[model samples]
Target: MTPSARRRVPAVHDALADLRWLINPRRRLLPRQPLTSSDHAPNRCARSSFVSETRTPGQASDYEYVCIITFIKEASTTLRRQQQLADMDEEVHGIVIVGGGICGLATALALHRKGIPSLVLEKSENLRAAGGSIGVHVNGWRALDQLGITGELRETADNVTEFHDVWQHENNKSVVVPVRGELRWVKRKDLIETMAKNIPSGAIRFGCHIADIKPANPGSHGAILTTLDGSIIRAKALIGCDGGNSVVAKYLGLSPPKSFPRLIVRGFTRYPHGHPFGPHFLRLRCNGLFVGRSPMTENLVNFFVGVWHPGGSVTKDPIAVRGLVLEKVKEQCSDEIVEMVHDVDTESLIVLTKIWYRPPWQVMFSSFRRGTATIAGDAMHVMGSYIGQGGSAAMEDAIVLARSLSRAAGSGGGGGELCEKKIGAAMAEYVRERRLRVVRLSLESFAMGMIWATKSMLAKLACQAIVAVLGTHSLGHTNYDCGRL
Candidate 1:
């Protein structure tokens, strides 16, 4: 068969199944109910009037016949081509990872590197390349190195050499600390696209929204995931790389991530000619407001502002988000910083979020794995970016998780059916290895957040003690590596 014909065969086969759903009476009526809502009532009435005026009852029957005939002809063609395509793909996969963000793709790539294939299910139709840049520290870089994309990423991002903190409440005190290890801010798009490019084609399936997940049966060896479209997927192992709102994590009986009463606005500013700021990562803290500026490249800078808002709510309007950031930073930041905020590209105002994290205690005790299913990244230990390890930590989770699973699958030999008992043990080990590391990060980040957000001096002192005991210094957490994948 010609290559073009082979490609058309699968497309037609998939289309036939999709058409079956489209032809269902129940499915056809499902969307019409929304049109009857109060907000759409007038439009619905107008549409009804037009239809009634355009067709008599006899003409309506003829119109329906035309539609039905066309649908039948297309479905017949789909079935004939489907047979010629000889598609016999299995409904079951060895490993299925939910969410195709940074963590999900990294986990898939890590498994690919170890010769264990994984299927990534992303709800979005395409890569979610939206959002601001992420800071990758030394530990994160190590994970990337194992995944074999460090060299490519370095070309797009420059390392952050120093941290410059300016305390406005402390009489404008300035402290400069040199970074001991690697730190670079790469655009979310760059990291995601680069990682995606290395992954095998057809490994990541888009537009697959998971509605429910359950064990195949009591004492079952694998998991059954139900997509919103009513299709079922069976997997020998399931990994959840979905973010803070992960449904897979919920299935593991983990508590939802707790929120901080703060609104963070992250935006990028561009200098077409050149930027004046050098390589230093700058931060300004005053009262309950915090601002950070990091250069991603020679002409582009990424900055964020955090305000201790009582309610963690921000308008979705881009203009309003930029204005709010400016309002919070103007009290303490320099005029140069203010100009940068004002000049921020309106389109780049993508991250206006209420910070959320799992408390350290929760991290220490939570059950991140159940049976053959487990979770990683934010789904396992979502933490605030106070320590700037959220992205990196997720990457670490990917490497460790893939490493653990590979060992288990390899023990039963490189190929053939996966052993569920071994897979569960590997998941437990991954959780055990990552628990303490992420707990420490959660503790330090929580303390730093308390110290910055608290108004009472007594409370601030208490948080300070927590920070002291944890020995949480800048660039300290970046030392440990997740080891080779």
Candidate 2:
């Protein structure tokens, strides 16, 4: 036998020794039963039956032997087949990730690197770019780095260095506060496109609406997803990178908690030559509400206004919405700002309703991993975008989950009797390790929003005074360590 094969025997022996310890904690170490090629297939191996032992007749000392039968193939072959069977038993033909947005694409690329294939299902027939402009904090860049797609993402994003100019309509003041650290501003479409380029064209299945999802089989790690057209697709894992109104969460019976009391209007406008805003810094104006501008590109400026809107207050008509936004800006902002707001093309405006929730976040599904099915990204924990960790958190989930699965697959277990148990344990570990951090982040974002959206003049003045004393050093630093994921 080859040296490598020779080395494998002791390894297998050691593994079996460890398995015995795991299966029976009270017993002392003992030699494992020898395994052969035919005894390892699922449903073929003898079910674990009771074994009794007695003294041998000829030997001077009493010795015990218990007959425990197990099916065996080559250890390596058995491992591979177990994984395949696990996949089969879970009813997971391949991974089916819902949403073709940033989180969905990132998860796909991460899985591909591990040699796992996946299909992305998007509800929209055409990739409609919404959320006109968005910012990627440093944590987001770290996530893209892990996916090996940061370079491509950077090419389409504007690297923001400073954020100082604060426009205050309440007091007609423009206070400059230094913003430390790095951030990137990009068109939302650009970020999506960058991720899409890394994946094969056929990998994304648009116009597929997932209506329902259920466990593929009892005690299995896969799920059966029923699409709108009544087509059933079995996926080993189901990642819900779908946005705020995720159907996956609903199907899983997770209802979003209510937290915020405001509506957000976002859009893009061409920067008129000689505009006061600089290309390097994000400008924020707080009057009765929050208004901010970030550079989308050299000639385009992305702007947003967040105002108090009792749930379902914003009109559906785009023109009326624009007018209402313009009115708000006019009431508190200077003429220069007013002119810019009016200049924005009505068709380009994007309006999103902002919602919030508290800590100790709960996953809509009781089981994160079942048979062969699991979920990640927004479908797991959807939070406010105040601190801009939404996308970053989702990417972290993908990396952590993929790593866990890869490690489990590398161990001889794969997806067999013991393997499923291992994967399930790992998923539980993930939730335990990740739940508190993401929940804390969500709570922090909610608190920050409250501070920014406070209507009390005394409270706003107190906030400004605190910032003046503390400086802008505390503006946007998140405590999360993305590198660990």
Candidate 3:
């Protein structure tokens, strides 16, 4: 056995093997193979099924049984110990929703509507109210409808009836897309609060940092989540809505989010009464830059400036960040654009975000679920915020994932005989239903970015022609409907 293998096998074996099974008749049902010294070779026999051919099955039958049983017993005992470390872990969950972002909160609401309880573990100390505003398109509203919060939300939300674009049109004209449906602007915090409203009290656990995930005990069902603060949680299903760099996505073998050579500075400006940004709102295309502003309310306008910067970090100082954003807007935009940003309060909420996009082709061609654990939203298909679909997509994912789990739970209660297969199939269905949409949106985001950066006049003209005629409102991007509530 290689020295490395010698060091690796025992720990895993100790964590997964069921000990009392050694004395149970079912123990022999578990296939066993003689462990040769070679089993200890570094990186050897790491496959799900660890076995060796060098030794015959009959080789020292008694000794083999003892060794195998002892190993499994140790693993089972170890798992039990780890699971018992926290008081909260005493009660296993039906499903554990990771991340408290839009996706997570929406999923919880979706599940609650179906009468299924879930534990939503959030890494943040509380709901996040930071970040730029969200442009919840028509399709996004479908999800809120299903979650039963759309009407109430609309009461406080600002309806954006116009769509205006700067840059491509001559004379610095802003073409408003003629799209039929409306887009609403909401501060990120307000949007999250709206979702949190529907989540049953005590359903969300705040300040829980998920450190790692592991396969749960075979008959036990679900996955095990180890938190940074030291808690182990087991659930029948593990859904990852954490974010682009999701721990669950990583555990499920998805690639890391691809970073773009871009960064964004976002904030909201408030007018004592109202601002004259226009009903259509404002989106501008600058050669190599993208900037936009939308009215989040009668008095508050939300804005974002995307700039190409090789440097990885945004300006550390909010004041400095604001300066950089204003400079970029003036440099890439017309004088009208310069004035739009001028009155922004120096103390406005300014957030610097590094740009990143999920790989579309990768998600399109691959499977999305492994066992009961699956992913949605940015965790599955993060993209640039150009299309204003990022939050919408997360909402859609929640609907789909919730429907899948509800079906699984309904088909067969959490019985050991059928739980794994049914829940796994449901997760697979979620992947199927969402994969193509994810591919389209992800690639579309990148394509839009390319158009924003293209210096070709003809190309820019062609792009304008499409948006102008369709009214970006009718551009058909918002033509999405998350299947029934």
* Candidate number achieving the greatest TM-score relative to the actual structure: 1
Of models 2 and 3, which has the larger lDDT?
A: 3
Regions more than 4 Å wrong, model 2: 1-92, 165-180, 272-275, 280-287, 356-372, 412-422, 451-476
TM-score, every prediction: 0.80, 0.70, 0.76
After superposition, which runs of candidate 1 have C-alpha atoms over 4 Å from their true positions?
Answer: 1-90, 351-353, 414-417, 455-457
289-394 per-residue lDDT for model 2 (tens digits)? 6777777566677777777765655665666777888898888777866777788867778766656553333542244444445556766666666667777778
Task: Report the lDDT tens digits of candidate 1 across residue range 1-485.
Answer: 46676455533433343355456766555433221112222324343342322332222233344445666798799998887554343278889999999999999999999988889999999999998999998888999999999998999988899999888899999989888688899999999999999999999999999999988877786888889887789888999999999999999999899876777778899989878888899988888778899999999999988877776346868788778778867877789889889999878886545678888899999899989899988998888888888899999999999889888987866464457779999999999999999999998888888776668899889889978787665567888889989
Error of 2 at 320 (Å): 1.6
Better candidate by TM-score, 1 or 3: 1
Per-model clash counts, in order, read 0, 14, 15
**What's the residue-level lDDT of 227 in candidate 3?**
88
For this target, which candidate reaches the highest lDDT against the unseen true structure? Answer: 1
> In model 2, where is the ten-residue run with the lowest total lDDT?
59-68
Tell me the lDDT of candidate 1.
0.83
